[model samples]
Target: MMSGFCRTPFKYQIMKKITLILVTLFVFGCKPTEKAVETKLNYQSQVAVKGDWQVTDVSYANSDYIKVSLFDLGNTKCFVNSTWHFISNNNKGSMKINDYSCAYESDITWYINQNNEMVIKFLNGTKSKKVTTGYVVQYVPINENKFQLIEQADVLNKTQDIVLTFERI
Candidate 1:
């Protein structure tokens, strides 16, 4: 017996519909998403208040000039604890290892422990520690390329102090 013609319209139609649906989905799904990117701010951009200040000279009572240096503790993810060191100006000061207990905010206010009576707060959110007494040190710029350490706190009995100042570098 001879076979009859077996052309089926449904098969081709189904294939066409499936191909169209797949193409439509692929075209829409492969599109790149419209993303809004946030611009990362530079360290300098946030410290606008310190922009007018520069390091000119450092002085430490009962301490050597060469022993002071600025310490960057950013590796610990504590931005607020970044400090200014007052070491012997001739020798490089030792790198500080700070144990970070909490996150730091960009706005950091530094004060000296004059009379050894000031309470130093810890990042752990506990009560501040009482120091013996030291001059609260501040970095001030007398002018461009000239700076001075303003001592507002009393230095009671501490023999040495570390002050770290940070600029763009």
Candidate 2:
């Protein structure tokens, strides 16, 4: 005895509710499962690092680029490099990064050692002898296209606290 217009909207509402509920359950109830295979490099023993990644951020000297390359160093460590180059229009100057190796000059290193603990070291070129330790916080994958590396920077007088977020390229 109901009009077609009334029934159509009522059915649409019901369908929407069910769809919303299903989406919520799927998103909240199911968490990403870590791959069963153990990785040789256990940077964070508790969490598995993503096997595939893309560059999310790059800043070198006066130039910045989003293209980066992540390379596996031995023992769950990694080396990231920038692959972007361009000419600056303002000064009519050329600027770009041709390398991405992180050494004492680059204040960044992350690794999961045999001890089953994650360690991050932020270095300054001047203080090559001393490395202040920071909490080896687990990074969260923001989405399919982004990786978030969050940690407190070094405790040195010149260090700046930072929360670095990178997008997978």
Candidate 3:
């Protein structure tokens, strides 16, 4: 099988190789360059925090991570009777703590602070005053309906780990 004059030998082979390389480059360049982390950042920034949330568990993320259930804290009645309603499209919310009979219902104005934490501006029965320093919150959402909120005593200080989980009601 020796052809003295093969039309598609050196020139055709080089052309085929260049075509393959160009196709590969084009395909790769056209693909999306966005990453999951960057996408998450963009998604989280615009996440909605307006809804009814309940404190499901409050644990300690220290050397010994302990999960404290609402009942275990001996505040089942208070926690169960409580209602947290966050005003939509705004940073205002209310926390009502009361008994089953609604004997002591207290609503408070809450706002999303600069650290993405819930700042209780004023309580219903307490000294009506906007708190300058507020608590820190780390909202870790699993999906649209389900999420976990990690609350902290201090936001500026990272020495403490997240120790709270709130669920949507």
Candidate of highest TM-score? 3
Clashing pairs in 3: none
Using all chains and alpha carbons, the TM-scores for the candidates as numbered come to: 0.22, 0.28, 0.44
Q: What is the per-residue lDDT of model 2 for residues 1-169, given as tens digits with 9 covering 90 to 100?
A: 5688789999999999999999999998897885332223443322343233333442322223222222221111122332211121211111122234443123444445453333444443424237654345445556555655543333233333233445433
Better of 1 and 2 by TM-score: 2
Each prediction's Cα lDDT score? 0.35, 0.39, 0.50
In candidate 3, what are the lDDT values of residues 1-169, reduced to their tens digit?
4564575587788999999999999999899884221211222422455678765544544424332333122333345435566664544567655455433344455544334444444354554454443343555656666555554433234444444455678
In lDDT terms, which candidate is top? 3
| Model 2: number of backbone collisions | 3
* Model 3 CA lDDT for position 167: 62
Q: What are the per-residue Cα lDDT tens digits for candidate 1 across 1-169?
A: 2333344566778999999999999999998995332333222222322333323233456433232222222221232233433222211111223335533322222332222221112222222233222223344433333334443322454444443334421
Candidate 1, residue 68: the lDDT equals 29
Give per-residue lDDT, candidate 3, residue 58: 45
CA-only RMSD, every prediction: 19.8, 19.1, 15.8
Off by more than 4 A, model 3: 1-47, 61-82, 98-105, 113-115, 125-133, 153-162
